[model samples]
Target: MKTLGVIAGREMRLALRNRSILITAAIFAIWFPVMSAFGVVAGAGGDAATIAGGIAAITIPVGIFMGYIFCADAFLREKRDGTIETLLCTPVSLRRLWEGKAIGVAVPAYVMTLISATVTIAAISTIAGITVVTEPLLLLHLATIVPVWIVASAGLIGAAQLALGMRENQILGFLLIFGFIFIIIGLQEVAPGGPGISPVTEGILAVAGIALVAFARFTAGRVTRERIVLTIP
Candidate 1:
């Protein structure tokens, strides 16, 4: 646990120090929520469900974006610089290292998710002149499903970055960014009626998020030092 904490702390510090990345992430985290809030108010008149849906639409993607940007520094940069090889020589196992790094990235990403949610709620409240109170299910989604998805994404991306060559990571990164763009566009299309967050839908999302996390953990476990080293370059 101590080792994990140390590793997580180190990654957090590294992430913070990268001012360009930090600024870019901050912009996305703030901008998307504010825009989504406006669109919700304009189209849906800021009903609770609409506000919740708007916030939900932006929050998950912002969290994923944060994880995507940070994972490059947390996972790939280390490999590229050959620092990861030295870390691999330590007593800590690869899985723990992956967990620590994923947690580190996910923490900040989740914070950004919270920020996006807050911004959305505040914008909706202001624009529609009504207090924003989300549904219980939406609250549950923010508290549980969102964070799990962020962790899952970071863990899975980190595992892939560690296991793949530089060329592959670059290609994967491009695909991830474009995939996020498409997801946001798709959400925009469905967001007009607001997401029908029935209990069943919530359950399915929760289950899917948990399964993704488990899959990421399994992928990380399969990553060996030799594979990581061989892939480096």
Candidate 2:
């Protein structure tokens, strides 16, 4: 437990040192709401709810991007640099290392989203004034999206590392992330009133995304003939 926490903190520090994470979070933090506000003010876009919804839409891809960048690096960097083996030489277990790496990546991505979302919400609330009202339940529902993205990304990146060996896995992560958002949009458009409209849908999408990533990672882990046979037994 202590080791995982220490590893997690180290990961967080490493992420903070990286400029891309900061830049990505900052750009979206400023970009989405500003664009939404401009559209609202100029009669060019949507009301507050629409603006909020648009912001939510942007968040899905942004979440994926953050997850891919952070989690992919977390899962692959150790293997690529040979640090993972060195860590294994210590008393720390593989599961701890994996969980710690996931935490390291997830903590930053989650925090960045919280910051970005807060800024977006604040900006929208201030500018639009009384034009649009936000429901508490809606805000709560939206807040859950960040953690979901984090878990999904961790699973995807881990799987990519195990399955594609990192080198060939890059494009798939990007595609999967965007592809997810596209699917979400398409589903919403086609079946807005479908049974998939509940919080259950949210749970399913999140679980499915993370589960797919896990499957990829697990598949990679069991690629060896010995491991495959062991599972069968």
Name the candidate that leads on lDDT.
1
What are the lDDT figures for the candidates, one per model?
Answer: 0.80, 0.61
- 30-100 per-residue lDDT for model 1 (tens digits): 78877777777776664677556656656777788789989998999999999999999999999999999
Clashes of each: 0, 1
For each candidate in turn, the TM-score is 0.88, 0.72
Clashing pairs in 2: 159-217
- Residue 200 local lDDT, model 2: 47
Candidate 1, after superposition: displacement of residue 132 in Å?
2.0
Give one digit per residue, the lDDT tens place, for model 2 in 6-91.
98889888888878757876787567656655554444244554554545555555666666778755766666665655676678
Model 2, 210: alpha-carbon shift in Å? 6.3
lDDT computed for candidate 2: 0.61
Query: Could you tell me the lDDT of residue 134 within candidate 2?
Result: 58
Worst 10 residues of 1 by lDDT: 185-194
